[model samples]
Target: MTNITKENFDKAKNFYNFDTLYAPVLPGLKATVMKHQDAITDAFYKELANDEIAAKIVAGRVDQLKATHKVWMEELFNGEYGEAYFNRRYKIGETHVKAKIAPYFVEVITSSLRRSFAQILVAEGAVAVQAALAILDLDAMIIIGAYHEDRMHRMSDVTGMNLNLLETLMSFG
Candidate 1:
């Protein structure tokens, strides 16, 4: 795993402008997000069920994935944006990569959940655009960070093998 420094995490938080305005509504956001968890998950799977790629990725495991996804949604709104939360997000991303799931599926599913969350928040009269966007942005960044890290690691291994082969061929020469 690529080590994400606290500085980098803090930088991201600041870059997203997740400031005092965002903190006040954390509890309310958590409640709202939790309340609509089922709807969000259902919508997510409904969309995935129609997508050939996504359906293939989740074939025969819809029930298990749905349960796991529910937990992920709960944790996302757990109101604890610490190292553990970040690590969980990173692992979720890494899991998708390792499972050979395409990145587009991840984006589509997450976007759906975000939209659901925004609608719930708006309906509850707690619309904070910056706060909402910041949450989504932070989650996206962590997930993408994991994906990039895994890709780079795989590429590095391939590069090393190529280099070793080149060195062996040059020795033969």
Candidate 2:
């Protein structure tokens, strides 16, 4: 029940160097993403559509998902890494779980995004590469972190095991 706490958010921020001087590059990131959004998303959705399960999951929601994806990408470069931001990102993870989004699809989409951003940045004169990647990593960390914690909680409940015990068992070879 406590997976998405402020403490965890802070820890994730620290892990990702969220307070970097490189943050000034956020505007460049924002500009590049906004400018190239259509192409970026076209490629992203193309990759998603290549996967049968992901395509089916998003069968009737391509436009809706595209809109949400743009919003998510915009928020990535907003340079407002606060607890509320963490809450929003974590809520996304929770939503993915509820939508039955597999971790493979999560990885696929994130990889697609990273590659798209990186390529666009390189093409657009490579602004704030470190800062851009750092923020992206932070966003991914929060989302995946919440997704994992939520999955853990559900598993713990179904198996009647404490989270610690479930985690211990998961660590076994």
lDDT of 2: 0.76
Candidate 2 per-residue lDDT over residues 82-140, each given as its tens digit: 76787898888778878888767777677777777777777555546667677777677
Error (Å) of candidate 2 at residue 70 is 0.8
Per-residue lDDT of 48-147 in model 1, one digit per residue for the tens?
9998888898899988999998887766655678778888888888888889887777776778766777777775565454466567767777877677
Model 2 C-alpha RMSD to native: 2.6
Off by over 4 Å in 2: 4-9, 123-127, 164-173
**Model 1 misplacement above 4 A:** 4-8, 125-129, 161-173
Which candidate tops lDDT?
2
Q: Please state the error at residue 91 of candidate 1 in Å.
A: 0.9
